[model samples]
Target: MNSPIIQLEHINKQFKNKLAVSNLSLEIQPGSIVAILGPNGAGKTTTMKMLLGMSKPTSGKISVLGQSPNHQQVRQQIGVMLQDVSVIDGLTVREVIRMVHSYYRNPLPIDEIELLTGLSEIDLKRRAEKLSGGQKRSLNFALAMAGNPKLLFLDEPTVGMDSETRIHFWKQVRQLTQTGKTVLFTTHYLQEADEAADRIILFSEGRIIADGTPESLKSGLTKRILSFSAQHGMIPGESASPSDTQPDHNNANSPHIHIKAQIAMLPNVDQVEYRNGRWSLYTTDTDTLIRDVIQRQLPVRDIRIETGQLDDAYAELLATMKEEQ
Candidate 1:
């Protein structure tokens, strides 16, 4: 693997009354897209600013492209899009792109920027102040690309983008990663990170609480939801009781209630909700549940098993962290 493009070791940042970041250490690999995720006041922005050299750490060392983050040589190789937009007002989009491009020895062509960023011809001519929120975000992304830097930092880069535009932006980002550019982005959109990032680092209360691929994180905190609709005579309070006059399947409390009870007893089964002839089972051991269902001859149809999602994992992860604190 290539050497890490950015590294922070035992970094700490303190304000007058609070510690914004605490002993944080991370290494970002080249050509990889890493998403920094956390709830509000989780030190996410502080960590990004420290890595970009916009804010100095109270202690410890930091490096970008194998040099001090603030080093002029390293600065030239990095592009940054901050959460707070700072482009001069009244400047045409093309002019702003050109101005930032001039600072770099090798910059992407203006036309290429427009194409890659999904900026229309009219957008290029419009003044920065006149652009809508989403348009301004697109321009911000275009400016970041102008430097043709090896590494890029985007904090909430898709803040105001519509769904279609956000999807386009991810496609462009993937193209950049293909050409060996490293990107470190922070987003409140968990699904965006889940979809776009190769790795996710979750921060909580000024520290990294979790780090892994989205699938792995989801597996850790979430369970598959197995659902099926069936008409079994299972009532809430009683076990299956088949009457002599009624068939077992027709006994309102017999088959369905029995199956529900059996499933609830299975190891690793979290919860079960049954209503209106529909059953929703939450479990980590889905295979066992399936096997038991088959072996027990539970009457079920329209079976649907949904894999765990990153959103559920994120919520559970934070909830667990809060408990630990």
Candidate 2:
């Protein structure tokens, strides 16, 4: 296997009394697309800054392209599309692309960059400052490609893009990896990471909280949901006996206490809820739950099953981690 394209070892970054990133370590191979995920103030942007050599870590080490990220050669091989982009004055879109091209030894052709960015000929003729927000984002994407960098760092790269443009952007990003390039992107849109990344690294409280493929991370949660509806006053408790009924003095509008009392006995059930006259069962093993319900001959109707999504797992993991803290 080839060497890791990026590596961070026991990295820590502090700002005054606040710790931004703490004891973080991970590696990414070439040709991989990685998603760095975290809630606000979770140190994701800080880590990106360190990796880009825009800031120094308080301690530990970092490597990009098998050399210190601060090295000029490494910088030349890196492409950055930061959240805040600056538009050069007095430059038309074409002129801007050409100017960025001049900064690189051998850049991707302007035509290829235009195709990759969905830039039309008319857009190429417009002045940079006059472009709309989405247009500017596309230009930023174009600039990132201009150098033909081995590594691309994109921060919220699709924020302003329309759905069609957003889809096209990711399609182009995938094509970039086919050429052995690496991509590291951070986004508020978890679905993008779920659909695009080879791996996800989650951060919280200045540390790495979770790291794995999207499927693996989701598997960590009890992900299958079995739900069914029942008519009012019709109840199907997984293992409820008449004696199991109890009073819900605490919640007057809560589901029937008798039904709630028997929820604990459900097979493979992690959580159970009644909302909108539907019983939603949270479980890891939907098959077992389904079988148990069938054998019991419950009066439930409109049965449905749903697999857990990345956002579900993300929420669960962060809640769990917060509890541990």
Best by lDDT: 2
TM accuracy, model 1: 0.84
lDDT of each: 0.83, 0.85
Model 2: residues with Cα > 4 Å off, grouped in runs: 227-280, 284-288, 299-305
Flag clash pairs in model 1: 233-252, 233-253, 234-252, 240-254
lDDT of 1 by residue, 80-119 (tens): 8888866678888888887877888888987887776577
For model 2 the local lDDT of residue 168 reads 84
lDDT of 1: 0.83
Candidate 1 Cα errors over 4 Å, as ranges:
229-269, 272-279, 302-307
Model 1: per-residue Cα lDDT at residue 64: 91
> What would the TM-scores of all predictions be?
0.84, 0.84
